[model samples]
Target: MLKESTELSMILVQNRQQQLNGNKRLFAWALVLLLFLGACSPKTRVLKSPDHRGGNVGGTIPKEEKPEGVDKEKTVEDARRAEAARNSVALILPFQLDKISPRTLLKEDVNRSAIALDFYQGFQLGLDELAQEGRSFSLNVVDSRDSEVRNQYVAKSEEISNAALIVGPVFPKEITSFGTHLSNKNVLQVNPLAATRAREFNLPNLVSLTPSIDVHTKAMAERVARDYKTGDVVIIYNTSDNDGRQFLNGFLSELRKVNSSAQVRSVSSVPQLNEEISLTGTNLIVAGTTDRFQLRSFVSNLEAKSSQEYYVFRVYGHPLWERIDFSIYERFGDFRPIITAESHLKTWTREAKEFKENYYSLYGVSPSDHSYKGYDAARYFGNLLAKYGDNYPEHITKEKFEGLFSAYMFDYNESWGFVNKAVSFKSYQGSSFQLN
Candidate 1:
């Protein structure tokens, strides 16, 4: 069995170094190539399709057209008919293929190009599974480098123009550039990456798989409203940061809708926190700032209060609390620390275990969060396209899909298109993370 949090925690720890060095993109590339190379005996090998028909092997797939009025057997004819009507899913990602050479693969290139390969591999697995269910997919894979010219070229292609669903173009700017061309069309664009919701690609058909900061806070507020009825909630915010203020505003809006009597407090020190915590029923403390110093202070003070507290104090903190020394926060007794996550993998599940086994067999290593994300994205969109045909968006919310590492429960926004409202609530229990 996969060690649930340890593996994920280690990956996060390793990712931080890459993130700080401005090389996290490269880190993902490195991990992907490491897995890919492990599958092969020799350094250089051409990746090919099982069937005779050609596919994009770290390159573009040439567009194939069906012959007009072609004669065929009944089975072949039915297959052809299904193929012609299959949903076109255009996957636009930054492969950076020109930087990579199978003959002379460098350590740095692997680091830089791993994300595209990893996502592609997992997506392929998902598509393969869908094929078993008689689902036809017209996949148009394009490499959109971090250049406007590349994005522009791909956006103008017939494959993309005629596509029913667009999977990526990972970065926010590229999404905007590609979406700008297809704004008038009813193409359902999926932003599989990026946490920030870009203003440029706020079209009705664009769906963001990664929920925004505001979305995270809103979900937390809703959960608090529904669950903590006995508590008198207090939102402690910092006055300096505009983003923090924005989060505070959203939290207050949601809090008012449910618990209209909840109080908002702007406190910076231990003395002020003590003053706020003196009188309460069951106190629901919300740390509204993302500042590390502020977080540390609040956490330390809260820990100090555990000895003398009469009423129950359950903490609901910002997601940035993950970056802090959790060893200290974990020391606090009965502190139900709640935070929102974009995606949370339940590795204990049979589906997850199966996916891990398949992945390890193929790559010689356990799968990471990115690998699971790719699988989920492909499974979700491919299944939807097969079931609903070209009009899949019309029936998006009809079914709810629980994937290996993610959940799909989308709510359509007129300005920002389809935003995934699903977020995982994790509580720090027994010095470990557990889904609540």
Candidate 2:
């Protein structure tokens, strides 16, 4: 079991790096952290902290650019006219309708349905919230789990073809395939989940709801450069794998943009990592390994080497650390680990509290992080569609959006279509995460 888990971890790391490099497809399973969500019991919990603001506010504002061939005056005028008419937003999800029947279904089938239903529930809430703001739009949900023939039928269907905004078609192949059919359309095609840079496809209207790898890595690098003195930072990475090398190189590139002389080190194993012993100065360690075995060994070695000191041995680690047994490594007060996040769930806020309560009331179970993500994505785009009409993509990067669970700041990359650049950092403080 441990070997299987570690193997999966390595694959995930490789997949993430491939997506970042535009060499391979993004890890589609990332949209649903199935194991994590399924293992936890459904229970409502609130985070009570002496300091209400847990983490550092993380957001990036991209410089606005004029949408090519778009006449601004005419677009706004058309938007105003659209406000009086009905707009449609289509959601394509993997509901696997054909598999669900009178026969006993497999465990995977049930789980997929649960995830889709949760996202739908949250999306409906977002629509309701938008409706309250005097914005009206027709909701169209399409199941992407059907046969490729049906999907092709959906691509040409009026429900999708006429949508002011189209969300989901979760898998990369599905998204890119749908995009191929809608290539000439002016409608917005939203990759509502995952961090995939579907660059291989020639999709002009494509945009992702989640931030990309470049955004997260560059943001984390910028944060480190801003917070700490250049001389005190050191990035330690594994040199054995392509993913490790990619992360190490990308992080160094971003760090160099801020501090040209920032130091870096590469180690393939614990034996190679034995050379470091500095403890007097405030040390910042940026770990680049995403493999479970490597991380476990690295943390164990670092933890064993630590001693009491006024300044802690601060580690800026990978997000996969949260999925593994990271709590055991946080035993010493002198050692701290920080992980970057696309969203930080604020349980104390009124909006969050109400959403959770309402979700629980409706489903009889506590919502997972994906639910919050779904709601935020729906609300953010819905608001823009209401104001900007079919040309919402033109003004999407114009304003900063502070969502209940995330902050939306978009930048249109010619090579990778539109990307969200907002990123948040969080540290495990006792039972919940605090902004770092």
Candidate 3:
């Protein structure tokens, strides 16, 4: 269904444009009437919530700037979008830069300091680019570790209320308090790491960079339908692990959204999948576990059976794909694994690659998806702060920005909560991952 959905988008957009033109003459007449009324009116007409765009209208360009090789007219249009893009990002306040004990996660390995610096390092890279482009940055590194005073919550609220974009305290409790508080402030509070199921909100300003359960699950299911449209889908999980449960929930959610009415199967242990696999004519499996031993065992069994059921056999999972030794991919031999990570290896920023290679060279082991995730989150939003700063709402709010970590599309739903604005799919097709 999504395959078709993606193809139909251009048709839909053109139909919308045709509808917009239908009322152009009427809009012109209305504008003339408005001008006539303005001449006779005692005060300028005022109505709240006027539509900002659309309709036949004329005015001076919204912004003006020099362009690379464009004439004056095109430069004006480019300037408007550039200004709008610059304004869309929000400014997240860090914990007080002067206050709080700077307690960093000490590196156990030799390259701890270098690896740890990555988050701030990537963020500064964005900041440096914006400054070179002649943009001003108004960033405040608040001491997030500050102890809260009860009455002072209001004062703290006032201090941050003006900030259109807020990054995070990166702790569950801090996220809860600030999330609840800022949900009302029209400011976005993005939590890079501390994604726990504390509560849900309808805040226009609040968006989670990570998919909680629903988005991940649904996407996994959609990919399943596409990859194995005729197959019986099985969800295998370890009952003990929380990640297993979270991923299983997501897999089932995705299955429900697919266009075809496919058979869905489930089981608790590896032994159960072995038996269930025999019964399901086609098996598309999701191994949802972060534990390496469990995942390895699961992979070994599934790979042994791949030749028997692979016409529609596919295996999928979460960011846990990062934790397991990737060299094991060749070990799996015939059976390929599909990991649902944020993005592909090549999708990393230039600094991201440098950090990864350098991190591996120093630490031996590579960084986990979560590590890059944190690096990307900090880098992305930190750059947002460094660029738009205070003027975030005017530009960032209206446009969807796709970046290294996640796609920052401000979409929300009343029932399911904020769908993770961005997610990329990659599959380990028995060897290296192939991005879809």
What's the true lDDT of residue 427 in model 2? Answer: 84
Candidates in descending lDDT order: 1, 2, 3
Query: How many angstroms is residue 138 displaced in model 2 relative to the true structure, after the best TM-score fit?
Result: 0.8
Error of 3 at 5 (Å): 47
Candidate 1 lDDT tens digits, 62-179: 4454333232333554664455345667777776655565566566676565676667657766765675555566666666755677777777777677677888888888888777
Per-prediction CA RMSD (Å): 9.3, 16.2, 18.5
TM-scores for all candidates: the values are 0.79, 0.75, 0.60
Best-matching candidate per lDDT: 1
Model 3: runs farther than 4 Å from truth? 1-118, 146-161, 181-184, 197-204, 231-238, 278-282, 306-312, 326-333, 344-398, 414-419, 429-436
User: TM-score rank, highest first?
Assistant: 1, 2, 3
Cα shift from native, residue 242, model 2 (Å): 6.3
Instruction: Give the alpha carbon lDDT tens digit for every residue of 1-436 in model 2.
Output: 0011122223334444333221122112322233222322221111111222233333643436444323454454355335523467778777665565424444555566666656765776677666655555666667776345556667887667666788877777787767777644677788877677646555767887777666667887886777676446464655565546655557877877997776656456677655643445556777767776777777777777664434346777665545655665566334566777877777798988999886665444467777887888878888887777767788987867887787888887666577778878888676444676
Angstrom error at residue 316, model 1: 0.5
Model 1 gets an lDDT of 0.66
> Per-residue CA lDDT of candidate 3, range 296-403, in tens?
777777766665655435567776565556565444534456766655446445855776664344323345554555555544554555455655445544556555
